[model samples]
Target: MRYAICFTPTPSDPLSQVAANWLGRNVFSGEMVEPPAIRGIGIHEIAFHTAVPRRYGFHGVLKAPFHLAPDVSETQLLRDMMRFSGSFQPFRIPRIEVARLHNYFSLVPSVPCEYMHYLASAVVQHFDRFRAPLSEAEIERSDPDGLSAAQFANLHRWGNPYVMDEFRFHMPVTGPVNLVDMPRIEQALRNVFEPVLAEPVTVANIALMIEEGTGGPFRVHSLHPMGKVSARKIA
Candidate 1:
């Protein structure tokens, strides 16, 4: 499976737990949620139910999926990736309301912070060691969804149609909605999560998350804090 270097929120964070619980309570089937490895975790519940089922369990996608070489163990890669990221310290993410394309909702920063862009770029560049870029056949997989011509072209060129100029940072919430339903979802979210949104959530750390071969539940591998500490580690 491919990997990415993303700053996934720590599992202990209240917000992270909230997001996960929301998924377990509202999305995944009870059977899926019962597994000990995945049960009692918010990300697992969330990752399992959303449109991307295997994506169930992470708030970050640092590296897109890639096959690991026979010699590389996930633990070894994680320890190295963590050391690489930890050397970097931590940073912050702004808070804002964001509209989502998935028939539902989300929250994101009003402005794309320079650091956020840097982090995304860093993941792609630094993690390129394992990536094999999306193949043409992979792009064709989306044909069932009937993408627009421009979108199709982007997938072939960029692996993900939503990156670069098309990128928008968001934390998922209720699934998609029409303008009419937005008000309700927004109010509900605000009522329950006002504390989370009252101020910006600092994205001080990036976490390495892994999915088992093919599509599997995304699990936390390691976390690296951002900032001077991180920089010092790299130095």
Candidate 2:
């Protein structure tokens, strides 16, 4: 199994429910949700466009997935995560929007957030000891040749290239779409997510997610609240 640290809204959060419906799967529950029908777009097209994000579910990655070191235990990792989260206070993203990220669409902050960056960096750095180094296959899978020099170096040193200075908080919604299809996909995403985005979203907890095996959907294992005061763990 591989473990990832992510920022997923609570399963009951309106944004989470809407995203799960749009993507046809709920990462929190590991269950399929029927996709809503769209005029002029076939269900198959919607399903196809969402296939990639559906597997990962609706969450912004904090720490990329990694194998546990042989000497590490899941219980120990959970304890560490719980302890680590206790030091920080919760913050909010003032606004969010459906934006094109590279070749795909995602929900991203409407403005830069220093607090979000700091939180993500802390998560990446703090739990790194639990990670096993990438295997040859994992390295090959990441396609180092496609990465920029700095990103390549970061990948080697941190196990994920997109953390720290490179990190942009994104909750992915679809697989790569052809540029020609971007306008329609963007409209679809905005139609579904805009209402939820109209209000500020809370960043109150960090979630521990688990993938049972290769190609499996990640499921929420636990949520650790962020604050200086001790908080209850949610499962």
Candidate 3:
């Protein structure tokens, strides 16, 4: 099984419910949700386009999936994650919007936030020791030759190319849409996600998501909230 560190909303959060409905799977609960019907979009079309992302569920990828190192255990990883989470305080992104990132649609921050980058970088660094080095199959799957020099270096170093400087926090809502279908899909996403985006998006907790095996749907393993104060010795 592979593990990923992500930013999933609590199961009860409206954002979680809405996104689960859109993607047709709740990563937190492992239940399927009915996708909303759109005027011009067929249910099959919605399902088709969402097929890839539906497996990943709804969350910003904090640390892309990786196998645990031979020396580490899931219990050890969990304990460290809890300790790491306590070091940072929760923060918010002022707003988010539906945008086509490269060829797919996702919700991205309306404006850049430095703190978001800092948090992502910290996550990548903090748990990297638990990550097993990428295997040859994994490297080929990532298309290392297609990556820029910096990305290639990051892949070998961090086991994920999109880390540190390359990280851009985005909550994917769809897999890929055809050019002719872009307008309809964009509108559909905006209609569903805009209301939730009207308020600030909170970054209160970090989640551990587990994929049982290749091509399996990822499920939430645990959530570690930020901002627990560590006791200090009085002088």
The 10 consecutive residues of candidate 2 with the worst lDDT sum are 226-235
Top TM-score prediction, candidate number: 2
Clashing pairs in 3: none
Model 1, span 1-235: residue lDDT tens: 6555555466666566555554442122212333223333344433433445224453644455555555567776766666666555455666655455466666667777777766676665565554556666776765726766665665665456555545566666655456775665556556545565655666777766555467655565556666565354431
Runs in model 2 deviating more than 4 A are: 229-235
- Report residue 205 deviation for candidate 2 (angstroms): 0.6
Q: Rank the candidates by TM-score, best first.
A: 2, 3, 1
| Local lDDT at 22 for model 1 | 49
- Cα deviation in Å at residue 64, candidate 3? 0.7
RMSD (CA, Å), each prediction: 6.4, 2.2, 3.6
Off by over 4 Å in 3: 229-235
TM-score of each: 0.69, 0.96, 0.95
Candidate 1 wrongly placed segments (more than 4 Å): 25-55, 69-76, 87-89, 133-137, 143-158, 178-182, 227-235
Q: How accurate locally, in lDDT, is each candidate?
A: 0.55, 0.89, 0.87
Candidate 3: TM-score?
Answer: 0.95
Worst 10-residue stretch by lDDT in candidate 1?
A: 26-35
